[model samples]
Target: MYSHWARFAVFVFCLTAPLSIAIAESDTGKNNPANLVGHGGPIKAIAISGDGKTVLTGSFDYSAILWQLDNTTTNKLARRYSEHEGAINTVTFIGQNSRFLSAGDDGGVYLWDRASDNLLMQFKGHQAKVLSLAVSDDGKLAASASWDRTVRLWDLDNLKPLAILKGHKGPVNAVLISGAGQQVYSGSYDGSIIKWSVKTGRQERPLYLHGWGINVMKWLPGKQQILFGTVNGDVQIFDLKADSIAKVLIPHQRPVLALAVSGDGKFLASGGGDGLIRVWNTADWSVVEELNLSFGPVWSMVFSADNKKIYYTGLDDYAVAWKISPRKIGQEVQGKFPRRFQKLQNMSLGERQFARKCSICHTLKAGDQNRAGPSLFKIFGRPAGTLKGYKYSPGLLKSKIVWNEKTIDQLFAIGPQHVTPGSKMPLQKISEKNKRQALIRFLKANTQ
Candidate 1:
């Protein structure tokens, strides 16, 4: 679906750390923390283990981190996996938490063994970015929805593709597997939800036609109902028994990006592009609590097994776990967050140009390899792809282009795709000559 508009680049590097690394824990207590800091870029997807003892977060940094959750003043980060060539979009613990799956912009689905922290398999068939993934209750089957307008069913046990289900007129954004593993439901940007028979590999029936694009979907506890959040900020519940929409709620004026159902089946949390999170009581579908996330849009969310906390991800570099029981309306202080790319009040024209054109993917300091793109420090005289640790694309590694004033200006003048064809650099251009000059001047002044 590519629900978020931002794009991040990638580079592979050797890992030197062991399985567990000690990180400074926030003193915000047990149920909630201000943030879990690890990923160098914005978090995009999150998943919690059934026992609530562990958390897995995927990010635009092209890595997924596993964390040990507890009530102490310190949290132990278990491991980090960085096999993907692009940003991670979805991650889930499957097969009784013994194995896991992660898919992303690279259109590749990765299966990993949790205990060994080793990649077991990689499934590739989708032609575009994979948006969502769902596993059956028994964990024997998995389904993936992609921007290619197709849904693929996989035999999780065999780690092979089982069937390709296609019917959507537009990109498929969300998918769900039935409790018994008999049916798969897929929702698309075309505003239609279709049910497919897993065994027959055919569309059994059309579920519902939402007026707006569906961004996310979750199954209610008993499997008799489905809850979905839309691109137009509407959260609607569909009654499977009645075969119609039963309830509708507008929690945000912008796109509803994330939704999570509590493990205990007591509460449902919905977050949107408006930076608001609304908690609802499942029995009555009434609002129980509201949180204003002053940071930015919510990208993904998950509930702790105990139902007392909701872990969410957004544009911020760190992921946050919010306390749910006390029901306090909390919000981050605006303009005070520590995001690296945030605009300063006294920023000049050249600075603004850098912030807009280069900040999201590139860093300015030496030894700052955490960002998606390589650090730009002392780049004015370097040859392309000559950085110490970053793994550049084959085309970039063989390119004759050097990082000079004329080359840098021309790189963005026509776009990276034109300047370095087949490179990992995203296709972005500064159409205005002055804006290009300002960005180049800013890079020259700061990158040294």
Candidate 2:
């Protein structure tokens, strides 16, 4: 999220000069405005090209957009690829930004040529949503993690399935291909990280285990270590040689949803449901800075090619960029709602409450529409985990509870995690009974 004045500053800068030069000039001060704002829905994934001259973003709008970065002109939207039938969950550049890969709730991976914006090929095998994707160093192979509880490897050259690596007890949330392209690592909702052999498609042994599900993970460059973000708000670094967690950092109060490491391997960034992005120094693992971007949960983040700026997306409809400066600390940026929702004078008190508290992450529309959470339209009579395009937690998928007034009230009474453990929904407890009742009433009225 960004403040009105901050957004205005960026707007003026963009209108006056090329973005690259504007950003370069702003580096002189830590108070400079640094956020890019132009998306229609919550962003799910972000990737930077190898040359650092381009950016790729995937969104719940069911499209991935390509942006070109240059000093001579404003960063322009190069293209918008809308081939996916469902919300895109993952996107990655294949080789030198010439081609890229994307996968979504439709359970298919699509390859695209950047220059032509053409769908080169479609690879389908997973029976469920693809949550994460990774490309091998050689760019010859791609690995995808899926809600099917399996990791599918694809031969990029042939555009065919190479192997299906199994063994995770729960849905795989994150996957990574080794720099040498010999090993594949996957983190799952089962709270285990498993390794697989690239040649045989056989799972090795569990590398690490925690009490909470792994939400995101990244491999440290040129090392046998990994940084993992957990659903319980902890980030741990696991050492391969020691086969144990070497360091644990508690930087978030809610689930850590995203993690990114700078290309130079000097900085590590982590974002969480608390709407905070923390930068850590790789040399000493000390916190360098904390950015308070008042968005909802940050779903994705990536470092700029020069590693001087970081880009992130989340509950908001735009991707935000922040300059990484050692001199800046505890900086705050505010975001404004859309013009349509700015004036709510006619809405009732209960409706206003719902809009303020529940609307950021959940939509009120029908037919399986999903934001950060599933739609609540006609929700009172449906069973949990029945949303077609949503990837529900394993506990919820097996849940037998139906949504009624009593259950809905209890959901807010104790929180969603208490009602359905391991669900992706964050802990949001409405302790006041009247408040919960009012919110539920507003939901019922709107849905009906």
Among the numbered candidates, top TM-score falls to 1
lDDT of 2 by residue, 244-264 (tens): 988888657767879999898
Among all candidates shown, the one with the greatest lDDT: 1
Q: Looking at candidate 1, what is the lDDT of residue 76?
A: 63
- Per-candidate alpha-carbon RMSD to the true structure: 7.1, 11.7
Worst 10 residues of 2 by lDDT: 16-25
State the TM-score for model 1: 0.85
> What would the C-alpha RMSD of candidate 2 be, to one decimal place?
11.7
- After aligning candidate 2 to the native by TM-score, how far in Å is the CA of 436 from where it should be? 22
The whole-model C-alpha lDDT of candidate 1 against the native structure comes to: 0.78
**Residue runs of model 1 more than 4 Å from their true location after superposition:** 1-34, 327-349, 367-369, 386-401, 418-422
lDDT of 1 by residue, 146-196 (tens): 989999988888888999998898888899988898999998888888999
